[model samples]
Target: MLQDSFGRRFYYLRLSVTDVCNFRCSYCLPDGYQGKPDEAFLSASELEAAVRGFAQMGTQKIRLTGGEPGLRSDLPEIIYRLNRIDGINNIAVTTNGYKLPQRIQHWADAGLNHLNVSIDSLDSSTFHEITGHDRLAEVLEGLAKARELGLTVKVNAVLMKGVNDDLAAVLTWLKQTPVTLRFIEVMETSDQAVFFRQYHVRGDDIRQSLLSQGWQPVLRDVAAGPAQEFWHPDYAGRIGLIMPYSQDFCATCNRLRISSLGKLHLCLFAEQGIDIRPYLQTGVPTSELVQAVSEYVQGKKATHALQSHNSGAMANLSQIGG
Candidate 1:
């Protein structure tokens, strides 16, 4: 087993398949940002090899993330390769949910068991305003398609103060589906911090807003990630709040992220990551790669200063595997 500076075990890996996205969400990629990477990101084979090496190091959970993972054509093949690894216990993907309806069944067949869809608002006009795209109805349709394919679905809503603070509308819309909804507090990722001050919503504020609407917390004793979970007494599914800004979960963060260009990020707010593509290209032994990953993990920070410091110059969420 590998451990970080904060005594957090490394078991989960978030892999970014590409840095290209169809939508330019306000919080993620602000409007009119034209900076795109040079090459077509990692090929399916390169990503598969990386996952295999990480899995050999006791990383059992693999989450495919991206500017939008569905934008990649060979995503299923990458998932299939990861699923075939010996130690991989779970294979999941975090998408904008724009293309899920057409590919949900294909993804399920490729061994993807769980999905987290980013849906900031329930209103179509509000969603279009937030995402810079008019695919709100398509996202809802994708959520339904995931459920139909028997995939465990989670809705990730980045809670902003005046943007989509309508918890009532969000909850009401979620009640109509079986997807578990999670409200994410905005973080201080590089480009995000530019607009962070205006849209920042603390996790405590989110909990209070929901409580005011008669939502009760449901406690569970289970392994943890970035989300602090709760449940609505009357709703069919649970509510989770991932408060990376207000309350840090670095002490229990078991995951590491890999950028689309094959860099390993120890923390979300970290400025730089160790490049592993050289090791991959050289056909290094698995043990050597594991040792490299161990060294990177050992350098993980105890906590992020997103609330107190400025991290607006760091890599965007699309480039750094959200």
Candidate 2:
């Protein structure tokens, strides 16, 4: 297993297939995705080789992320290849859900069993204002289809002050939808410090409200992310909170990240990503790739510095599919 100096063993890998996104969420890409066309993002073969290396080191869950992974035309093929890897038992994708209604079947057929979609608001007008896209109905339809196909679906909503923080409607929908809805705290990045300060909402307040309303905490699975899940007997769905600013949030860290350019990131706010693309090139031995990855994880830090408002090299969340 890949154990860091702090004794945290990693079993999950978040791999960014592309840095390009089509959505213009207020929190992430307020200015829109401004990047050169067809940048040198990871190819299907390169993604497979990277996963092979991680699997060799006991990584069992692989999450395909990006600015929006749905933008990748070969994403299904990438998922198919990762699913065939020996130690990888779970394959997931985190997307904006723009193309999910049309492409979900192909993804499901390609061995994807877990998915997390971004839906900022349940109100159409609010969703449009937050995401810069009028696709709330369309994305919700795709989510229904995903459930019908037996994939574990989760919805992520960023908790922002005076924005989509009102969760009454989302909770009402969850009573019937039977999917997990996770509310994420707006984190500070180097470039978005002002926005973060203005809109940040504390997740602990929401957790306290849920606890008072009879919601029961659920134990996390070994491969689960930072979301603290809760269930209520009156609702069919569960609630989760990703409080990155919470105290000791990284104590349970069990995942590493790889950027679209194949640089290893020990934490989302790490100072820099260590380039390991050379080891992932064609014909490189799996052992060589594994060695490069193991060495990087050995240097992983115990926690991030978001509490101090230091985002390090992470100017934007999309850089590593945060």
Highest TM-score among the candidates is held by which one?
Answer: 2
lDDT of 2 by residue, 98-187 (tens): 968999999999999999999989999999999999999999999999999999999999999999888889889988889999999999
Q: What is the lDDT of candidate 2?
A: 0.92
* Candidate lDDT (C-alpha), each: 0.78, 0.92
The stretch of ten residues in a row with the least summed lDDT in candidate 1 is: 217-226
In candidate 1, how many Å is residue 257 off?
0.7
RMSD of 2: 0.8
Give the distance in Å from residue 288's predicted Cα in candidate 2 to where it truly belongs. Answer: 1.1
Model 1 lDDT per residue over 1-322, tens place: 7777667777888888877877888887876445575565778878878888887877888899887888787888888988999988789999988767898888999999889998888888998998988988888888888888888888888888888877777667657665678888777666665677788878888778778878776563222357766666577777888887655556668888888888888877777777888666546777777888888788777887676765633656677666
Model 1 ranges off by over 4 Å: 37-40, 209-224, 312-315
